[model samples]
Target chain A: MITVRDLAKHYRVHERAPGMANALRSLFHRKYKTVRAVDGVSFEIGAGERVGFLGPNGAGKTTTLKVLSGLLHPTGGEVRVDGHIPQTRERAFLEKITLVMGQKQQLIWDLPPAETFELNRAIYGVSPADFRETISELTTLLELEELVKKPTRELSLGERMKCELAAALVHRPRVLFLDEPTIGLDVSMQVVIRDFIKRYNERWNATLILTSHYMDDVAALCPRVIVIDKGKLSFDGSLTDLVQRIRPEKRVVLRFDRAVSASEVEMFGKVVERTELSATLQVAQDAVREAVSGALARLPVADLTVESPPLEEVMSELFARSRSEREASA
Target chain B: MRRYARLFAVQVRASALLAMQYRVDFVIDGMLSAFSAGVALIPLFVVFTHRTSIEGWTFGEALVVTGWFTLLQGVLEGAINPSLTTVVDHIRKGTLDFVLLKPADAQFMVSTARFLPWRAMSIVTALGIFVLAFVRLGRLPSLTGVLLSLAMLVAAIALLYSLWILTVSAAFYVVKIDNLTFLFGSIFDFARWPSSLFRGVVGFVFTFILPLALMTTYPAEALLGRLRLSTFLGSLVAAVGFVTFARLVWKSSIRRYTSASS
Candidate 1:
């Protein structure tokens, strides 16, 4: 449903030095530097595919999403949403896609969310029946019956975000570009948002491209992941592939009945973390069973559970590796 | 076109609902609108008291200009300023993304995003001023005069709205335009007086460059049956030209809108 080929969005930003004399000098003789916000990154997302875009701060994830949603004209290359060029922002193209930015909101501040939904209904030229159906569906799914009636400013952050989601979905957009949609929400609220997004995708068979620093959000919703760093595509594949490629190891966390020595755990696998009563061992994927059996047999393991490394640690390690590789290449 | 009309209604309803959201603000705004309308007339009353006529225009005739000025002020404050000022805020916060992503004309959406219903008090006050001016002159406008002035009223609104669009389009590049808008408002103060009050370049600037006369004086002159039909037609054409040009500028600004950091 979306195709981006060698897309780039470069910004020519003015440069100004600190201190009085330099500031004055800049007023007359200004300097300009072109920052490559998104340079030559390309990817295609098929219809109904929920893909997660992962990156650190200023990694061009948001910029790429903006290009796909037609908010910012790409400096180079081509982008198409469904069948229409995004930059043209033809009405039909816009009607087919919706962007939800968690940092920003579309709800009318002083008015009820219903008002915004009504406004979108008119703006998108949705039929009265369809509008009703969409709003009803959104309210039920998000449990937004009471939240929609109150002024947006009165709602808590989570409630407002719920309303924001409902407002964006009023037209039933087929492609959802969610940029940090669950940012700053509490864990439960984040889970709720994640679930609603998944349900929406499932119900509509919508194409979804989500950019979030919250790894849990991506883990729970997106089966495939695309990673961008420094305006370049660093990784793209299934989440499992990314994890396997970055850290092909399993974590065996053991709870001991008594204090366990680090040396005892290291005999089975590399000790990742440990405390007095518990220890975590990083064992290679293929040898995880042998390591767990060894640890179980050797240590007084009251309880043991094997799991994948935390996604946050895996992502940072991946980003760190990419940066170091770039440094090495340079 | 039909869809836009329905969309307009929805937008206006949202603004009206917003206006009523805070009762204190609604009441305060109503009071301010009335007070400002009275204050706007004070200079006219003071000038008329000093001299019955200035440069061939009697006090009653000039009151017609103030009347149209008040009406356009209504359109400016109620319809134009409230909506367009939010464009700067949108540009700052990057909320303009929501607006651009909509399946509608971005210009129409932003231009109608807000309205202050209480500001309609100025419109009522303008009508009152019109009635008083004509009664003092002891004559009603001619049928043709009324029709011409009505057309001029439409043109005046178009001119004012287009000028605002031009000012707002700057926000795309400059980002912070609070002072520029302040300068704009101060310059707009020129419209309260007769367009020909200033001589030479100042007069030329107000008449041609900024077209303040097209906004207020022409409509007043048309109402008083003192305006030539050709002049009215010319100003009408100019108003439409300004609108088209403003639309072009707005389109280019949107194209240049990089949007604030996400």
Candidate 2:
């Protein structure tokens, strides 16, 4: 449903120096540098597929989404969304996609969300019947019965995010580009948003590309993950694959009936964290079963669970590795 | 077009709701606008006090110009200014993505996003003043004169709107040019008087280039029974030309916007 080839977005930003002398000099002759916000990245998304676009600050994930949704004209690249050149932004192309930015909003601030929904209905040329049905379904799914009528400013961030999702989906778009759609919400609210997104994709067979700082959001929603760093494609594959490749160690989380010596757990594997009655050890994936069996017999174990390294740690390690590799080459 | 009309209707309703939320500001805006109109007319009164008429235009005739100026400004402030600034704000803040991703014309969406219904009070007050001035003049414009004036008024409004579009479109290219709109605001202030008052280069610029005076002056002159048919038609043609040029500028500007961060 989406294809991109050698996509790049470069910006010529004015450069200014601190201190009075430099500031005054810049007033007459300002300097500028061309920064590549997104550079030569390529990827394809199939229909009904949910993908997570992961990157650190200035990694160009949001820039990529903007280009795909027809917001930004890529400096150099070819981007096609469901057979439409996004930059052309034809009415047909727009009706098929929706982008939800957590920091910004489309709702009319002073009025009710219903007004914005009505405005969208008119702009999208949605029939009254379909508009009614979609709003009803969205309200029920998001549990937005009382929120839609109140002015947007009165709602909490979580409530507003829910309404924002409802407003974006009023047209039932086929492609969803969600940039930090669950930012600033509590855990449960994030779960609600994630579940709603998955259900939408499943029910409509829509293609989704989501970017969020919250790793849990990516893990629960996107099966495939694309990682970008410094405007380059760093990794692209399944979430599990990324975790496995970045950190090949599994975590053995043990609960003890009595106080356990931290030194005893260290013998089996690298000790990650430990207290009097609890311990965590990082063991190689191949050695995980052995480590668990050893710990079961050695430690005062009451209960134990074996799991892969947390996604957050894996991602941090991946980013750190990429930066170090770049530094070494430099 | 039908969809735009429907969207505009909803925009109006939405703005009405907004106006209700700030009723005090709405009332204050209208009063201030009327007071400003009164202040603007003081110079004209002084001009007429020294002489009953200038170039056959009575003080009452000049009032027509003042009234139309106030009326058009009210409409511009109430509807066009709010919507246009909303466009600029959206562009700067990257919120314009909402409008662009919608299945509608971005220009139309930006042009009709916000409305300040209470600003229409200024238009009503201007109309009252125009009627009062017309009654005091006590010379009914001939049928042709009235028709010509009405046509010129429309052309002038179109001309003004076009100028505004051209000014705001610069934001797409120069993303940080908020003060660019001050150019139009200054030119619009010149429309308070007839274009003929300023001769030579200034007259040529306002009449032919920007067409600022063409919007109010020609209409006011026609209503005052002093407008020549050829001059009125010329102003109408100029207004249409300006609108077309502004549309082309808007298209080019939209092409220049690389969206939010790109």
Q: Which candidate should be chosen as best, given DockQ against the real structure? A: 1
Give the per-residue lDDT of model 2 (tens digit) for A28-141.
Answer: 998999999999999999999999999998899999999998888888989999999999888889989999999999988877888888888888889999999999999999
Give per-residue CA lDDT, model 1, range A1-330, as digits (tens): 888899988888889888999999998999999999899998888999999999999999989999888888888989888989888889889999899999999998988888889888888888999988998899899999998888899999999999999889998999999989999999999999999999999999999999998899999999999999999999999999999998899999999999987777788888888998999889999998898888788889999998999999999999999999999999
TM-score of chain A, model number 2:
0.98
| Interface RMSD values, listed in order for every candidate | 1.9, 1.8
Question: What DockQ would you assign to candidate 1?
Answer: 0.73
- Classify candidate 1 by CAPRI docking class: medium
For candidate 1, what TM-score does chain B get against the true chain B? 0.97
Question: What is the C-alpha local distance difference test score of each model?
Answer: 0.90, 0.87
Residue B175 CA displacement from its true place in model 1, Å: 1.6
Q: Write the per-residue lDDT of candidate 1 for residues B98-208, one digit (tens) a residue.
A: 998998899999999999999999999999999999998999999989999999999999998999999999988788999989988999988988887878999999999
Lowest summed lDDT window (length 10), candidate 2 chain A = A260-269
